[model samples]
Target: MIGRIRGILVEKTPGQALVECSGLGYEVDIPYTTFFHLPDTGQEVTLHTHFAVREDAQSLFGFASRLDRDLFRLLIKVNGVGPKLAAGILSGLDADQFIRCVEARDVNALVKLPGVGKKTAERLLIDMADRIKQLEGQFVPSAGGGSLPEGAVKPVTGSVSDARDEAESALIALGYKPQEAAKAITRVAEEGMSSEDLIRLALRSMIPTK
Candidate 1:
């Protein structure tokens, strides 16, 4: 139940971030939507988090907004949905977009999300339409953002190949097959695009709106 973390962002990949707080680095799994909001490698960032525990593992899932985090809590309670799938869903669509889809019964939009098939999409619409009512008035900006740390933080630097490699790795981590990730990256990649841009474009290609 670690609800929030404010610290220096040490590292950020498309699916994860390492935040150093009080001299300890916390590895927090994040969705690409949250990833898009991250400041450079060394800045104060605040993430609304949900701590998950099981017999075998523990994980912290972080979100850029309280609404997204709250929606995530409700999503995990849905039948057959778990934290990983819920994270993937948020990566594709933030909470507002997701709520609209559920309200509109947009199965096509949900199905386009990574790892979600038609049956699962329909399930989300039916299951979440009512459960989402609990999240009213909760959309707020994350705290500790737009501020620098006490000391300077060295930025992470990488080459073009590095960006491609990181983007592919991130997609694979999100449950896409290696082949699929590679193909998607190859299809959208261009010279000088950062890993974030590459990942965003690839996901958009996979989950187009029209």
Candidate 2:
């Protein structure tokens, strides 16, 4: 039931962050998008958080924006997506672009994301489009640099991998074969592009129809 936390950011990684609150340190998993926006270590920061509890495990997931957290919740409802995959998806694709892909039934776009396949992308569009609209109504992006402590290493390679995965999933979701999607994503990745940037580049690589 811990909805938010405000504290000193102590550490950060691709999918994790630690915040010092009330003389205690808490670790939270985060998507790449959140990591990308994080501030330097030792800064005061605030995050919207979701607490997941199970018989054997308790974990916190943080988002820079409420929209990101909402999307994370929605993604976990998909048949094969887990918290890790959901984090990966959100890290790779921004909320606005993801909503557009779903609305357009762009399986190509969906398949381009890491861990998303053709069937999965199709399922997401068919099963989740309406839900996206509902969530969109409540969306508000966070306003400042992300809450990260000082000396956090920039996860550039991680970001690239996230982008490549998303781009591949999107290509498949958009109707390209899985093999094609993989190939396109690989080519885009080779160009030293970010995930969002790779998505754009991969789209251009699609075979142009007469």
Candidate 3:
């Protein structure tokens, strides 16, 4: 298992990042939540990573935090979930939010995520509710202010529309139909919203939980 990666960020898109370690460029698949936290191209970035191997293919998935990576591992263990769907779930919500939803039995919020239906949501709640307890020590509040660790670089902000495009592409990559992605984007469209904002708002609008 490739547990971590430290490299220069060569390029980044909504769902992928090209990172060069030594002379080789590694393409790392990442959730949108991780993508949102990426530093600008050409900067040194570090990610907690998981390397998955199958007879047909091999892939590396990266996350901004160890908690996110750990939660992803748990998600893939669900009866009906796989790496892609697990990644999609993390793309829609970070580890903390997802854990909160599971703890609260927020099926409505889970169903709002791309590719998750009611049955899947229920499965996630039942299966993940206990698994999330393992992540308690790793949890970090997203809204709590904190200084960047030494050697960490800040992400660059892009235009609002670019953010929208990024968020829409992420939703579509998570298995949403193009039209559905567009409608969701349109519904939450607002001035000055970053891609992260658009994604969070769009999801909240679609999944109103108790």
Candidate 4:
């Protein structure tokens, strides 16, 4: 189990990052929240990671904090929740937000996340409510405090269309049909929105309050 990684960030996208450590470049699957905190390419970065292995493939999922990584491990244990879905959940909402939703029993918020439906939201509320307690001792960055280290490379800005494309791709990755993803993005999108903003808004549009 590769629990953590510290290396030079080589490349990054909305859903993945490449970090070089010990002459080996590791492609780590990451949530958008982690993506938001990534340092510029060629800078040092570290992530708390979980290595997943199956008969056919191996994948590394990483998070900005130990709490998020631990929470991710708990999420995948829920019935019907797999690694991909668990990653999607963290992508849409960070560990802290998700824990708050569960504590508040906010099914509306949970369902709004990509790949989560009523059933999944209910299951998360029921199952994760207790599991989240295990993450209590780990350090959790405060809201909006998950940025890269001081003096690290500044984040690269993208155009509105790039944001839309990223949001659409994220939605598709979470099992939404491409057409559905496109439609949702189009509905809530505005000029100058970031990919994270577009995705957040699009998700809210899809899952309405009861």
Clashes of each: 0, 32, 0, 0
**lDDT, candidate 2, 141-168, per-residue tens:** 3335323322233333334456677666
How many clashes in candidate 2? 32
lDDT string, candidate 1, 18-129, tens digits: 9999999999999887887788778899899999999999999998777778889999998888999999998887676687678888898888777888888888888988
TM-score of 1: 0.81
lDDT of 4 by residue, 1-210 (tens): 999999999998778999999999999999876776777789889898999998999999988777778888999999999888899888777666677788889998887776789998999999988888887656434457752222222345455456788889888886678998999999998888888677767765764432
Find the number of clashing residue pairs for candidate 4: 0
Query: What is each predicted model's overall lDDT from 0 to 1?
Result: 0.81, 0.69, 0.80, 0.80
Of 1 and 3, the candidate ranking higher by lDDT: 1
Which parts of model 2 have CA positions greater than 4 angstroms off? 139-210
For candidate 2, the per-residue lDDT at 127 reads 77
User: Which residue pairs collide in model 1, if any?
Assistant: none
Q: What is candidate 2's local distance difference test score? A: 0.69
Local error of candidate 2 at residue 174 (angstroms): 22
lDDT score for candidate 1 against the true structure: 0.81
Query: What local lDDT does model 3 show for residue 113?
Result: 83
Q: Can you give the lDDT of residue 167 in candidate 2? A: 65
List per-candidate RMSD values in Å.
5.7, 8.0, 3.2, 4.0
- Measured against the true structure, the TM-scores of the candidates, in listed sequence, are 0.81, 0.67, 0.85, 0.79
The per-residue C-alpha lDDT of model 4 at residue 137 equals 55
